[model samples]
Target: MADIVGSMRVFVRVVETGSFTAVAKENDVTAAQISRAVTALEEQLHAALLHRTTRHLSLTEAGSRFYERAKAILADLDAATDEARNASVSPAGKLRLHCAPGLAQSTVAAALVGYQRDYPDVTVELKIEQSMPNLVEDGYDVSLISATQLPDSIYVAQALGSAWSVMVASPDYVKRNGMPLTYDDLATHTLLKLETPVSPPDEWHLQSTDDAHVLPLTHAPLQVNAPDVMRAMLLNGAGIGTLATYSAVEDLAAGTLVRVLPQYRVRPFTVFAVYPSRRYLEAKVRTLLDHLRATLTPALEAVGERVEAMTNTIGEAAGQAAKSA
Candidate 1:
């Protein structure tokens, strides 16, 4: 079979110009190749498309009707192709996003605002929840998830960055119940456990530079399933709880919450940008993911710095208090 679209384009031009040689010259091919393309198209359609002569070329009745339809089809094809191509250069569409709990606030949310600002034509719809959404079923363009490991799925997971969960207690809680210094010490203190999709209810892994120690959480006096509730309880002097950097950034900076363990952090959770397909990733989704990686990664890094700074300060104070005693 012939390349029908190509032949149709050449045939339309040949009818308008009334010469195969003119269309061939425009296409940078010999007239013979152009003539052959028309012949193949005519043979495939079982109709005479052109009435050719020594000096003149004219379209048959079938060719005249086909010419009009072919022109419209070719115009539609070109317009659709241009629209698809322009998406990469200037993204303009609606992006639906599903974000995991505690991942949509602070830096992530701000980054989303920045993305919309930069791409004014794009409308974003965001849903934040604990349950992992079915990207295809739920009609989500992308999912921002933070987990130690993601479940196996047909989606493509792109690494955004990693964030450490730190043990935090309110100033009143620390003053009243005292702070836990080690894994053994933490076993004795009140444990306000946060149960999320990313965390196990039984244990919390305390990760240090050298190694990680699993702190068995056999006793949880208060167990909550949400980060906001855990933060609220910690603020009420309930107990020490784990908080991701994004969740604790403001509190840690404001001195409302203090780090419980300066030397050990809860095992880091990795953030991933999940989508249905990588090869057919659209511009809106691609740009938003890139914006997230650029914005969220830096924000997490800055929070990490602040975390270290607070840890150093807390460690120094503990050192002085021990020495004075």
Candidate 2:
């Protein structure tokens, strides 16, 4: 009839302290109340768990065996409670993070650096792949995805920012081959294509102020699965290829690579930090999501601004050239 778990605690304390009086004093309860708790536990188990006298108390054979198991169980329960409480308050333990490979190097990696510095107890396991991983199956705490649509309705997504592909070529290649003035001009030039598991390999979806177009590159001379490889090839004047704005921000800023189409835009994809729809969000997961949004949103915005500035510069130059002609 007595609280079974509470009785166990009293029994363990009585055995540890060697006297009901001592545990009673420790818990600010009377010795008789402590004795009643042990009696209830013994009655529930139908086994005498202690050999008691006025001056001495000791565990019986059965009591000794039960004591060992009970102590272990209590210790494990205490540890589990502490772990859960700590995880809710402080960011600690291993957090598996899955991210798209193209954003891994610049945006995700940079945010993780600051996150680790802030939360030293949280160990981050970062996995970068081109394909989206199953978060619940793979045991990932969070995933950063760049896509037009969310993979499933089960995930809670926070939009980090927008991501888009941009057609880029080296300044030297533009000078020699002439810049593609329109989407139609892309057909006459050598095109470097990105082959990915998620998207069509030879097709690009482009948009303008008033219309959207899907351009299929049927004669791409070079194709690769890696974004870095595509960037390298474009830098070497291999051909015009589409690079994610985040991937090509540096090249565009340095004037090494120029945006090919100023008037047209690639279809933009939203970047989201997604996690399972759970009742409670752990501190580690929530903090990292916040860190990602704070860092990546600005980084993506900066890339957009830089690309826009470059586009305006190119447009102004073209207009001046027309006047001179």
Candidate 3:
């Protein structure tokens, strides 16, 4: 049998353009090919779909009825094809995003701001939860998580970046207790601890070139579950607290909080954009993932650079003081 859809398309084009040659040229097919397609369509339908003369071509009474139906079929097919293509490329509709709590206040929010500006059609519903959500069961398009390790699952985890824990104190606390030059120095300082369900409470893990140190905050003055609370406390000069780079970048940049022990850093936790594994990833999810990778990675790197610079400055001052003494 002749391709009914292809023939219908050609027949509709022939009727609309009113010239076989015009349809052929427009479709980049030979006029003979266009004529053959219409002939095949008419033979299959058992009716003449067009009346032809030397000067012009017109549709017969039966042709007019067939033309309307064929035109509608072609239009519907075009609309369906366009809808599929748009779904593949264009990011529209609602994207339900479940993100880690502290991330939204950091680069995640900034990345999303830029994402929204670029894709005005996409509606992003962001939920901040401490726990990771089941992407398939919860109907979340994406989940942003911070963890030392992600559990084995069917979900695909794309690393946005890593967030290293940095020990920071307010200028007031530093001025009062002086800067901690050694790991042991932290013992004398009032340590503000963060007690998260994901990590152990009242313990700061530090790593340097030669040794690994775990500072037990047995008598920590304040302990909080949320990073923002810990950051607020640190900003208020409550004590020295270890915080994720994402949570402390702004304060570190403004010199409100200074990084301590630049040479030693805690275990760097990774931030992942998690989504359900699929043969074809949705455009909205893919676009947001790309945006996060582009924006969040650089932001985290900048935080690292600023923290390194601060560490170097502190180290230089300590060196100069030793020489003078």
Best by TM-score: 2
Model 2 C-alpha lDDT per residue in residues 1-325, reported as the tens digit of each score: 6678788899999999899999999899899999998998999999999999889999999999989989998999899999998888889999999988788888788889999999999999999888878789989999887887775578888889986888899999999999988778988998888975435787888887878888888898899988888998999999898888888888988999988886777778888888886567899998897788788889888878877888788789989999999
TM-score of 1: 0.81
Error of 3 at 239 (Å): 1.4
What ordering of candidates by lDDT runs from best to worst? 1, 2, 3
Q: Across residues 238-307, which tens digit of lDDT does each residue of candidate 1 receive? A: 9889999889978988999988876888888888888999885678988998898889888878878888
Clashing pairs in 3: none
> Would you list the clashing residue pairs of candidate 2?
none
Worst 10 residues of 2 by lDDT: 193-202
Instruction: Show where candidate 1 strays beyond 4 Å.
Output: 30-32, 48-61, 131-141, 150-158, 172-178, 209-212, 219-224, 275-290, 321-325
* Regions more than 4 Å wrong, model 3: 1-85
TM-score of each model, in listed order:
0.81, 0.86, 0.72
